[model samples]
Structure formats: C-alpha cells, structure tokens
Target chain A: MTKNPIVNGKLVCVALNDSEQFNAMQAEFAEAPYKGAPTQPVLYFKPHNTWSTDGAVVEWAEGADSMVVGASLAVVFGKECCRVSQAEALDYVEGYTLVHDFSLVEQNYYRPDIKGKCLDTTAPIGAEVVSIADPQALTVITSVNGTVVNETPVSQLVRGVAELISTISYIMTLQPGDVIAVGFPGQRAPVAKGDNVSSVIDGVTKLNNVLGN
Target chain B: MKHARVLFNGSTLDVTVEDSFSETGQLKSKADGQLINEADVTWLSPIAEPGTIFALGLNYADHAAELAFAPPTEPLVFLKGANTLTGHKENSYRPDNIEFQHYECELVAVIGKEGKNISREDAMDYISGYTVCNDFAIRDYLENYYRPNLRVKSRDSLCPIGPWLIDKDDVGDISDLKLTTHVNGELTQEGTTADIIFDLPFLVEYLSKIMTLKPGDMIATGTPKGLKDMQPGDTVVCEIEKVGALVTNIVSEQEFYGDKY
Candidate 1:
C-alpha cells in the first residue's frame, strides 16, 4: 500500500484542539475566487477561521434553517505551477481523492463570502490518492447511505481533465500544494445525519463515509 | 468554533483557527502579529463564505442537451463574491417577480492551503477539505448568455452552503461522489461526482492557473442535470456523497424581510 497523507503540512487546527499535521496551501490569504475559470483567473482567500478537523460535524443550526449532505471528487496537488503551460502542467499533479464539501445556509444571509465557504469542519476530504494516472481511464461512482445515486464515465465530461490543468497553468502559477475538485453528478439528493455516503472511481479508488451532526 | 488565518508563511500557507479571535481573543498588540489565539476569533467566515467563488455553466450533460449545445469541451467556470454565501439553514428569498429561483445542486470545493499554479502532482498538499452548496440561480433574471451574471446568478443569498469541512485526505477518490437535491422532502435532482467534466486535479491546476487559490476560497463546481425551479416555502437540500448536505429555505419578497422596517 502506498502512503496516504491527509494534508502533509505542519500546522493543523482540528476541533478547536490539536496541533499541526500538514499546513494548508500558501497564498490563501491573497488569493480570490475565479472571475470565471478561464477568462480571468482571479484570486481569493479564506481566513484560517475556515478549518474543521477529524470526523467533522455539521448542523442545521438545530432547526434554525435547512440542511443536506454533498459528496465530491477532489485533487491534491503534488507540486506548484506558476504560469506554466499545458506541456509542463501534467508534471505538477500529486493525484486525486474525495472531499465532503459541506456548508450551512441561512435563507437570506450572504456575507463574509469566505465565512460561509470557509466554515470550520465544512471541508472533509478523502485519503485515497493514486500516485499516477493518464486522466482517461478513470471511473467514478457516487452513492449516499448505501444507495447508488450517480454513475458516470470519465469519457463523458465536458472537458477532458488534462486540458483544464493546462489552461489554469496559463492563468496562475501552480503551487506545490493545491486542490482541484472535479464537478459532481447532478441527480443526487440531500442526506441528513445518519446517512452513509460513498463514491468509487472504477479503476481508481473509493470514497466512503457517513454523514452526521 | 475558532477564528483562524490561512496564509503564506514565507512560501508556505498555514491555517491558524483560534477558538474566539473575533469576539474574545484580545488583540494584545496592533501588529499583524498580535498575540492571536485560535479562540476569540471574530473574523472567520462561517464555512459558507468562499474566498473566491467558482461556478459552472452547462456542465450537466442533460442540461447541456436541453440548451442544445454540445457537451462543453472544457469546464465553464464563472465567479461570484464571498458576499454571496447564505446561511446553511436559513431561508433564501427570490427577487421580486423573478422566475421562481432555481437550485442547482453542486459539489463545492474548499482550499486548505495556497497555491499559485498548482500542478496535479502536488495538488493534494494544498487542500484542507470539501463541502456542498445549492448553486441557487434566479432563473427569471438569467438572460441569453450561457454564463449568468448579476441578473441571474449572482443574486444575494442565491448560494446556499454549509455545516462542515472534511479534510481532503479523509475522503478518497472524489470523482465518484454523489449529489442529491430535495425540495420540501421531495427528491428533485439526482447526480454524481463521476459526471464532473473537469476532475479535481485538473480543476486545481486549471483553476490555480486562472487565479491564485487561497485557503478558504469556495468553488461551486458544475451542477448536474435535473435543474428545477424553487418556490417560496420550499426547502432546498443539496446533498453530496461523503460530504454532508446543505439545507436552505425559499421565501417570497414579502417574507424575505420580516419587518426590518
């Protein structure tokens, strides 16, 4: 078995306690969200106020509003790419994994854009990462609470995975530590606490976890 | 809950979340290096505020076909503001007379570290975790351009996000994750992570090139097929596999503001 590292950083803040594991990507404070993936590779940053750790827990604010669960595929950057080109983009990838991108939404509240997107314990990523791949021969499956919610072929994506990497390289310089989350299927529904969710890419790896409060 | 800062230390980024930096942590000194504690944090964005927001256009094969366009050759990404995130359990109000709000269940991305142009090789190192979001768009205002702008997509509170963040390492191969959307307990949208036109590694590398992805930035990955309109009083739940779900309610203009007057 290959070594599967969580963050591979030095400073980790989990559950209001604990110490470092692997720090997050640098430049986060200075970066901003894209103005659209290609036209203007923008930058955004979330304060450290956004991290949550180990078996992260989310809530509906105890009936203050509504809630649901989501599952996704994420990529862990092996290295960095700064204004790199398509030709050199492939070399920077570390590989792929899973992430439980969770969030809390109040009906009409929207501010501190980073606050909602950067909530503690709002991000849950998987540990299974394959060291290498050609981008074409991968398979992916999405499930919730033991139910097969979505099934797709890598060949169906609107953009072949590799090209996006190259395009992004042209916009921003890739760094040693970064994450790329592939899009998710559109047919699944929300799961509450006690719901088990799992996903598996046929020739790749599987992401399995349970949703909880 | 703690207040933390994810920033570049020389060339690396570290996440420092204090328990209460916002309301309690006394800024001992005026220097940026004030004795900050993970506690007393007042400046933290509740997992809903993304440093930068990323959205997709017609990534859903079905939605694409409905729009009569070939499946995109690449992911169609767009941007929004951290100011657009709504509370996870609160209610979202539709603009006056706008077509009923439509909810697109999507896989939301959260960066753990900072990366300039992140290569797929070392991409994993940058991630802290992931979450889900209801990429709410005001269909009535969305115009001809495939990319919805202020008229349709960027409405305040149109984006519903929430509850937790899972470390990227804890959840494996995300490509196959699932997404589910519920409108008042009725299943409305069913999708999977497998359909993502741009996989995670590529997204990071591609996105990083376009912009510098900082810790806490939120990416609302493309939504799947089955896009539907939401109405007042309808609760929308966006559930993704592994990642917890985000729930939000829909309200009418009259109900949006309960007598702030």
Candidate 2:
C-alpha cells in the first residue's frame, strides 16, 4: 500500500454540496431548526486521525451495523489561498485525488456530525494526486464487492470546485497541501463490515478500502 | 511551568513564562538565558503547530439555556482548522456587516498523549496542560446546516488562544476553576469550570472514543452564559483560573486587513 498523499493538512468536507442531496433535504431545511436553505456552504472537518491510506481496513464504531460510503474528488491546494475570486480559484489547485468519505448514518443536519463523520480511519485517500484538465468533467464510480453501486458526475455539485475554494478561502485561509473534498453526489452506497469498497476517478486515482471490526 | 512561543527579535522562540517577575510578566528564552518583558514580544499560540482543534458548543447548561435550547445530552463538538487560531494579544476581525459577534471564554485542554478509546478514568493522564481561548462567533453568518457553521465560528483569526500553557500539574483541580471574560476591562461573563456540563476528563474520553487524541490537539471547553456582543476596538480578555488570560482585540475588517479583504 502507498502512503496517504495528504500528510500535514486538514480535510475540509462540504456537506450537501451534491445537488441531489440538497434538493432531497430542501423540504426539511425549510422546516423548524433549519428555517431556510443554507446560504453558505455547509462545512465540516475530517481530522488527521480519520485519514488513512487506500486499502486500509476501516473499523466501524462499536455497535454500528452499517455506514454510508461515497467517493469524492478532493482538490489539493498548492498555495496559501485566502479571499481569491471564483475565476482565479483553480489557479491554487495543486492536483486532485480520490477520497473515500465514510460516515455513520446520520439523520440530523442541524448540528455538526462529529461522531458520525470523524471516526478514526473513516477517510481513506488515493495514494497520488494527479493534475486534471477539467475537474467538472470527471465521473466518479463506486463499487461495492465488485458490484457498481453509484456513478456520479462532478458537474452535479451544487457548488463547483472553484466556487467551494473561493467561498471557503474567503472565510479561512487554506494552506498549501490542504484538501477540499468537493463532496459526493446523490445517495451514498451503504456498506457492512467485511465489504470491499472501491471508488475510482478514471485516469485520475482509485481508492479501495474494506470495512472491518 | 508555563510554556510559551513568542516572536522576539524577528524569530520565533520557545520560552518559559515567569508570572511572578512583574505586572507585565516576563519570559526566559529556552535557547539562551535572555529574559524579555512579555509586552515586548508578540505572543503566538503556545502550541507552535496545533493538531485537530476540537471546540465544544453549549457544554454549559446556562449557555444552552441562553440560546433557548436544552442542554445537549452529548457534547456538541466541532472541529476548527488551524487558520482560525491567532495568539494572545492578537486582533480578531469582526466583519463590518455583522451585527452580533460574541466572545466565548473557554478552558482549553492541550492533549499530550496519543490514545484512542481512552476511558474516562485514564483521560486526565493524557492532558499536558491548559490554556485559554476566545472562541469568537459571528451570529450573522450562522446557518442551520451544520448549525454554527465554519463561516460563523472558524473565520481567520477568530479563535485567539494562549499566553502560555500551564502544565496540568501546576493547576491542581481541573474542575472548580473560574472562567471570566472582561470586555474593555469590565467584567461581563463569569462562570466556573464546575458548571461545565461535560468536564475535561469526560470530553477527553468522549472525543478519543471517536478519533485518536494526538499530542498538540486542543479541546476548547464550552463557555458559560453571559455572552455579550463585542464591537470593534473592544478588548476582550478570556481568563481561566490557574491557566493564563488570553487577550484579544476586536478589529473591524477594514482596520484589520485594510482594503485587501
């Protein structure tokens, strides 16, 4: 197994960045607790302890029967970015990699999902970061135990790569090598213990991990 | 002993603070026996490179009630990026468009050991020291999705931590410490660590159960009630008993970054 490409940086993940996911939760968002749709990007952090290399076994939280797993195209920043306009946002991109974002099934969106998303080894990234011509043109496919589960196009994002970096950097500076997972699209594939999950961004990178323990 | 990192003579230096020296205090450089007044040096966050920064929200019953919500059964933990961290005596920008920006006086526990699934009984042994931080929140930017989103809490320089890290041994009982916030030298927010719904040991065990608690990782325990809106030029001091007082100056965006922002 290769070393995780992300060594000394934070993994900032945007929730509900997928258009389908946003639309699906739009009704609930308008109800009490939410009141309205999110004006700014819903952000959360997957700390370093959660980071693992591809092919590593991710242990499930005690008593957790299943988990939601999805593949995201993660943009790695090459420079310290702060307050850059959307037009120039891609210039700071170092390259891209695939990240397996695993989370315990969560129904609440009003509070930060720390316990659900921040479990150790929950996030596994591809070994390499390869430069891409157009991030939005890519398609990510997730396979569970050799069966195709979900295929998502990067263009289906509510906030594209550049816009996410632009808006996030406007609030907090992203250091060199920092990652922004553009977010998974549609519904994620549910995986049980011992299931081998693979996510591939053809010609870019592939991350494969198995659920265990 | 209180450990600190400061900028002196155009270089960063590790120093041991001597609180008994004078009113302004003094620090002795570890490299050499150079003693310098605290006012002459720029204080950096005590931990040079902090790992994951876990911040609790509404961990106090009074604070939970103030927001008109019931005290959370589980700790409302949120992660903060390194960009949000400034140092003692630093300026935290309060955006001109925002109406209510408040300061949260928190007792920050610095993790000294790496562990996972650490039991509450052995949790305190993993702590290296304690510090203080002002977790500034811009109420205007708060959205429901991930309520208290990064925009509202993790803005650049929004979290000011340190002055120094007082070793856990130096501070006797972690609980029962007084946490006070004074804005412009007037006492505004005051509470004791005894009021912390999820105390340090409980938080350590709770967080470590989900993820590995690494050395340099910090947990900013939630503040109590009495949150008051801070304006530009307001000098907010968040002090915890035994741990040092973290002072932050609230500056407007225009003043903090000028037209660059």
lDDT of 2 by residue, B1-261 (tens): 999899998999999987675565778999997888877899999998799999999999899999998999889888888888889899999888778999999999999998988999999899999999889999999888787788888888999999889999999897799989999999999999898999988998888878888999999999999989988889999989888788899888878776657
Candidate 1 at A19: error in angstroms? 57
Model 1 fnat?
Answer: 0.00
lDDT per residue (tens digit) for residues A13-119 in model 2: 88887898889888988998899998888888888888888889987777787798988999988898888899999999989998888999867888899889988
Clashing residue pair totals per candidate (backbone < 3 A): 191, 0
Residue A107's C-alpha lDDT in candidate 1? 21
Which residue runs does candidate 1 get wrong by more than 4 Å? Answer: A1-213, B1-45, B144-146, B259-261
True contacts kept of 2: 0.91
Model 1 chain A worst lDDT window (10 residues):
A13-22
lDDT of each: 0.54, 0.88
Q: What is the TM-score of chain B alone in each candidate?
A: 0.78, 0.97
- Compared with the true structure, what per-residue lDDT tens digits does model 1 show for residues B224-247? 777678778788888888776677
Q: Specify the highest-lDDT model's number.
A: 2
